[model samples]
Target chain A: MTRLNTLLLLALAVTVPLSLLAGRVWIDPFDPALPNAAVIFAELRLPRAVLALLLGAGLGAAGATMQGYLRNPLADPGLFGIAPGAALGAVLSFWTGWAASGWALPLFALIGAAGAMALLGAIAGRGGGVLLFTLAGMMIASLAGALMSLAISLSPTPFAMSEIVTWLMGALVDRGWADVWIAAPLTLLGLAVLLRAGRSLDALTLGEVAARSLGIDPRRLQLLMIAGVGLTVGAGVAVAGIIGFVGLMVPHFVRPFTDRRPSSLIVPSALAGALLLLVADCLCRVLPLAGGELRLGIALSLLGAPFFLHLLLRLRRELA
Target chain B: MIKQSNPTPSVRVERSRETGARRVSTTLDTNGGLECAGVVLKARLADVTASLKPGEVTAICGPNGAGKSSLLAVLAGLLASDSGAVSLDGQPLNQLPAPKRAQAIGFLPQSAEVAWDISVETLAALGRLPWRTSAAEDAAAVQGALAALQLESLRDRPVSQLSGGERARALLARVLAGEPRWLLADEPLANLDLAHQLALLARLRELARRRGLGVVLVLHDLAQAMNHADRVLVLDLGAVVADGPPEMVLTADLISVVWGVPARWLGEPGARALLPG
Candidate 1:
């Protein structure tokens, strides 16, 4: 069963890239009459595909890391307020006119994510359990959301609110290589941190006392996990807005494949997430929707909400 | 009556006064033994002083807030002591690095809820974390532990799908895979059925006798403790009231005074029991 899951994941890895490369709308390479197609392929579609892969991988890995660290399958970057924090930061950047400057949105997003995580850590305190941390995270997320709403409400220009709303809803439409470049390095760094944390995470599955008995310092690990999640989710939101459900869904989808080990779940979830996002993007392109340009976040959430509800019901049953 | 045997001949003993804590010399008697003096445990754990010998299963018994878990935590090295010291083989336990200490000590908490839904074999493999063993060796250890626990049939099943008793056995397999010299289990028998409880106790006793492993268990059931434990360390309100053989430790006065419950010891030598008054 495990080998079959691995083979399935490998197949998905191969096919996702091929599908990304083979789009239905073919671009003519050297036709002066079709420069627009060349530009779309070179500048928009290619970068969007790459960004989708990177963002998906980052969020999935981040989700796995969060679940392991918190010792709860329900844990995700969004649940911990990292995504909303990043969105708030990006909105602040745009409202302050910093979006005119290169990389400013990402910078602000990173700062916001780090700040929210720090606040969460403070509220949770040393030796505090997951309940405390989750409560703190929920509080911070609500505070950030309220502030974001206020920012949108008080915007002087009509374009500001529309831009804020668009960003909040998340879109990968106009993302180019620059956004990809900015997110890629940070995502890779986050992945590295989480992968190195695999052994500790496994130890943690037995609870803090057991992990401590295994020579793991849970407090230090929690801090590291928070920082890693912050970096990945912050960078992702900066590039793609508040893309929901990927962080929550990807790890769970790939868990059975990894035999449910945190060590194996990290990388596979990343690959699975990248594939899911790429497929969703492709569907957005081909679907005959009225908007023609479907919001990636909306499409993902529409598919992911039921899955999330199912998981919640399963967890409830298990607990019962 | 079985008397305490002489310390093992192969073991080495040393005493150091550099930390201003009482030093207990290590001696490897036929049975693995542990000695602690002036040991100041974690911030919450009160000062504790005790000695334990192998060939005997000792149960550390106390009320909910009696620092029983904290003491176990200290002995397991999960929490570092603030003042006193613990020693194994006369070497200071606090002085060793965390992983090295873990190799010598196996700990099982009252309730261990695994976060992931991993297969039993993979979960057992985690026990070899402190060892520099190869993947094949780790696999062998996992298999051995599973077989010992009679969990071979359930090795491929996810722990989440297992029953409560099965989950406990699987975790026991994980701890056994570590092959620690000393076993410190905190309320391990809680939530288990009568059959599983008896089975677990029997397994622990077998391990202690066959491998000469020092077994320290924290139990709430005075009756079970008296029935299975060779020695009983009774704690009340964070202080040891009695530390001796089960018959002597489970006396009526101590039981009533420490537990605030009326109980009596029944039966003759070799088949003694605790009965509710």
Candidate 2:
């Protein structure tokens, strides 16, 4: 591991524990006859923190894979409409009051994401050009957004409509072990597949003919990477709704520290992704508010968008 | 255009600028070659049959769109032949596993487009990817290739920061790090200055002779091909129009027929040189 990797890993280890700590419902490290407190910590705070870490890592890795595979800095798995599709699925569950049903929302969300990708492929035809890519993404996001609104409008009352709308903005509040179980396996599998794309992607930078000559079959690699991105982003949106910029920004930040080799960046990007989200979630926990914690995605965007602008200005100044 | 009625083996080394400094020749052993039989590839590549032998550099020269790149792609197993067979050694090329094929054959396309602005060391190390799952051998291999291409000083420099010729050499070092038995390059001399082009060709020739490596290069510059290649394979309209020792194969008539410019040859005694009129 490089010095940066070691530092990132250390940061991640500290972040996760810090994330689990400082919640409103606090449990003493050791107290007689406080077994119920321990159960609450295990069943509630720990699962939420773990879910946030996994979701962040998944989105980050998937984003990195999409960017690397397409050779585009702006290609976000969420922007590709998978996250909107997932949000739509979760909205449908909420419309039908399926939020109370364990894991049903995530399950429906995964299907929605997969279906959106399939639909995107059918509409755009194997991602031919940058225009088609953006067009397909817009179409899927619009359709999913429209459908989510439709689901809310069809709800029994204004309360249900508001519930689905808030959920759509993205959150990790009230999550449990069920959310963790639902997302973990698929996210890890997706990450593994994406990481495997490092070598093929490196070959691809040499161009199509060269990559093929280097013994990397681009067709096979593309199929595997796209599927991996879909699964990862799908699982993340299923649990955390639609956290933006973590995917798009984390890789950009981590890339400079890495060798800039697509594959080598995956692990570090994932770690940073996990840490970034942990900080955001932990901030949500630690901040005192009369109306409980702020929504996770809002906090992320609030922090991330400003940082993004700062980076852009710095980049421009450097270029200038 | 140079026409040689009789050519000598020692003339190959005598022609190069680095005549003596860059050689530790092996016994000139020759085997493990690629053979294409009646192969028809993408629309660009038609029925082409040729043999590339180890321990010698063969230049595939032709006018633009003469299937030079397509032929090399087919040989590298990047493209499947529509008809006929290409065998590495004796086994069918497609049947070879990708990792094994990568180890045996190194291919460099004309474009040196690396998406990331990575270090030269990291970029060169990519050529050793097939063998990377093993121990720390990749570092040594990367170093050896960088040194071989005379890019040791630029190893830590970012590829984006390197000059045009330096970037070209870095990409070449990537291919060399693979330690392939057969190295196929498409129009590698493009964008290089005269000095670097000649130096690269000389280095390739030395590697072929010393490492028992087979090299097939698609060259637009007929003059460079005629001077460097042991054998010249000329393609016209997707077929091998001429194939033999460079001295025997290259002539004003063939050059005029393929390139469509009337030319005459003036040869020197030191080495068979081409001077077009």
Candidate 3:
């Protein structure tokens, strides 16, 4: 185990309890029997904290798998268009007046994500060319993005638009154990698939022909990636709306811990992602923002965009 | 340093003659030769036939589009031919599972596109994917390959950061670490320097002579092919123009016919040969 991976895991463990402590009401960890302190800690903090940790790990793993399978270092979970598809589904849940049905939005989002994944597989061909796959993902994202915009534009009520906007920005407020149950199993399954498919990713470093010659079927590798990303990112976006940058940035941060072996980077990236999102969620609770509470996704985007810009600059310089 | 100069050809192939000592239940290694009979790749092969005997180094040399690489790819199962069959020890090549086939044949493509900065040790260890060897066994094989290729000093460095010649040796070490029965490399000597190229050829020749590993390589240098390989298979426009000993196969007339250049072969027997046009 590298020092960075060890630190990331240590950070994950420490950040979990810290996230539980960062709500509007300062619930003391030492005191158990205060007025509604246990209620606030149990009913509110625990689920949100656990959900953030797991979803962040899923996104991180997804990012590592995408960059590896596509053979591009800058790749992320959202590159597959699953995130946008999930957003579109969640938006439809609002427009169709099904948002009131506890499970409709996330369920709709999962279906949309799965559909987009299938479309990507069909368009990219069974051979799994990086350019073709990226183009297919872009097309899927564009279609999903267009549909989301159409839904927002065609809304009959302004209140619905506002509600939709708030949901789309993403929040961890008032989430319960039920939300955790919805996303946990799927994310775990996805993470397992991605983690176990390391051999193919490692073989892929030698390029398609060499990887194939090494007994790795490119189609099988792509299928495993598609299924893995679909379940985790789909369930994640369905629950938390569009949490951007966790997938893209965590891999780069954890990459140094690994010897550039894509397989070994999975766990470290997962741990770092959990740490990042937990920190972000904690920041959302304590930061003195004017608008009651800050959105978790907005906080991630704020941290991610500049990091992304920096990476772009580095890439440009490397190319130059 | 250099394993040795041109080794005396010994017919002791790597396979153990003690039949009961075999570990695996598969018939993967029961037969000896890697044979391609009437193999027809759509645009690449038109019922081509060739065979590689155990513990013998064979070189296939030809022009750019002479299907040297395609032939190698077909042999390595990297390309599927429309017709004909490839058999290993008499069993069909495609019938065997990927791991079994990989166990029998190690392939080195012309260029392996590396996307990350991985250490040489990690790069070499990837060859053990086909077999689940014990940790000690894996370590020994990786170390042995590195030592054999004289890459132990560079083992800790990132393969992506190595010089072209160094990277080529590292990649070769990766394939050798697997200990496959046959090695099929496509123009592996192209990026290597003159000394390394000769050293590599020497090493391959020794591997065939001592370990009984069938070493097949694609080469552009006719003199090098004639000097190092026991036999030469010359391809021209996807057809085998010549197949025999170096003396019988690489004549001046054959060079003109295949490579489209008139060249004179100048050298004595059992000595370095040079092709000057």
Candidate 4:
């Protein structure tokens, strides 16, 4: 591991313990008089923190791979439409009262994600270039977003409509070990797939022709990107709603510290992403809000928009 | 325009003899070179056939839209022809595994761009992607490539910070680090200065003569081709108009008919210049 990776790993170690101890009802690990403290540690905080790490790592690694594959710094896995497709499936579950069952909701979301991946692959065609793949993803995202809106508007009950809207805002509140069980394996598998694509992504930095000459199979690369992004973003939405900015923001924070090769950036980005999410979730728990904790998705978006503007301004200055 | 003082051919023959012995001692196979048997690429190339040999520098010269770049791409195995096949040593090029083909042939595209702000040394080391050998071997190859391109001083600088000529040299150095049996480049001198162009031409000739490497360059300058190349292949429209030694193939009448410029050669053989009528 590089120095940057080692540093990020150490930071993650520190943040994990802090995340468990900093909730609304703070638990002092050294104190013995508190009631149900062990239950809170085991039942509530542990699963949430683990879920945050898994989902955040998936998104961060996916972001770095996408940027490298597209050769565009602004690329994020959310652009692939898998997240919105999963959200649409979850929204449909709520609208039909099927979400009352535990497994049906997540199962439906996974099916939705699989459908989007299939659609994207079909539309991009065999051996299609990155430009075609990107345009296809944009089309799928718009279609899924429109369908979700249609489902929300046609809800039979106002309570169902409210539930769909709040879930779309994205949070990890009241999530149990079941959510962790669903996300953990899929996220790890997705990270493995993304890592496999890293060296090929580095080859693509020299343009399509040069990459091909360097023995990179474009078709294989496209398949890996689709599979990796679909699994990570889809599973994340199935459990935690639409956590957006962790993917886009985490890579930028970790890039300057590394050698800037896509392969070298992935592991570090994943670690930094886990740390950022754990810290942010801890803050959400500790802050006093009359209407409950701030939604993780909403809070990230609030921070993300300003950071995006700052990036654009800096890029423009560099160009000038 | 031939110069009596120039002993380029004799000097090249002596170097080839020395490298020929070296090639036999090593495992280098020189019996079968890259060959395209009657390749046709849908209005871009028509029945183009050429057998390129090692220890020679061949220049492909043509006007714009004359299929120079397409031919180079086909030869580099980056493009598939509409009909016919390209073979290396009697084995079909398409049948060879991608990594194996990459190990044997290095290609530099006309407008290759770096997507990230990596250092020059890092960019050169990317050539070892197909090898993935030991750390010491990879570092030595990268160091040699940087020295060949006169980029050793700028090895630590980011590619984005280099001048246009320096960047061109850096990209070519990447192909050099691969240490392939053949090197194919398309319009590599487009952005280079005169001094850099001459230096690069000399380097290619040296690699071909001393290392027994086959070099195919797509050059726009007739003077460079006439002065530096051991053999010249001229394309008019989409067909091979002429193929032979530079002096015999690049005549004034052929230039008038093919380039429609009515140009004539001036200066000595080793330092030739073209003047338009």
Best by lDDT: 4
| All candidates: TM-score | 0.88, 0.86, 0.92, 0.94
Worst 10 residues of 4 chain A by lDDT: A119-128
How many backbone clashes does every candidate have? Answer: 4, 0, 4, 0
DockQ of each: 0.66, 0.53, 0.58, 0.64
Model 3 Cα displacement at A218 (Å)?
Answer: 1.7
Give stretches of model 4 more than 4 Å off. B1-31
Worst 10 residues of 4 chain B by lDDT: B12-21
Docking class of 4: medium
User: B-chain TM-score, every candidate?
Assistant: 0.86, 0.86, 0.86, 0.88
What digit string (tens of lDDT, one per residue) describes model 1 on residues B14-79?
111123233333333222357665555433444456777765688998767777888888777776
lDDT of 4 by residue, B1-277 (tens): 2222123321111101111111111122335989886677776877677778877888999889888999999999999987767888767889999989999999999985999998899899888888879999999999999998889999999998999888998999999998889999998889889998998899998898889888999999999999998888888666777777788778898888788898888898878899999
Q: Per-residue alpha-carbon lDDT of model 1 for A1-320, expressed as tens digits?
A: 35644775787667565554444464444444654666766787889888888888888888888788777787777878888888899889878878768788878887888788888778767774666777788888999999888888888688877877877777787789999889999988888887878888888888877877777766677777777787788889988888888988988887765777777788877777778888888787667778567889998889889988999999899779
Question: Candidate 3 lDDT, tens digit per residue, A1-320?
Answer: 77888787787777777777777877777876669887888899998889888898999999988888888888888888989998998898899889889988888888888889888888868666667788889889989999999999998689889989999998777889989999999999999999977989998888887787778877788888888998889989888888998989999987876788899889888888888888888889998978689999988889999999999999999889
DockQ: which candidate is best? 1
The candidate, 2 or 3, that scores higher on DockQ is 3
TM-score order, best first, reads 4, 3, 1, 2
Q: Which stretches of candidate 3 lie over 4 Å from their true place?
A: A1-5, A31-34, B1-31, B270-277
The 10-residue segment with the lowest total lDDT in model 1 chain A: A23-32
Q: Per-candidate RMSD vs. true structure?
A: 5.2, 7.5, 6.6, 6.5
lDDT of prediction 1: 0.78
Kindly provide the TM-score of model 3 when superposed on the true structure, using C-alpha atoms.
0.92
Model 2 misplaced regions, further than 4 Å: A24-40, A96-100, A117-157, A288-292, A309-320, B1-32, B267-277
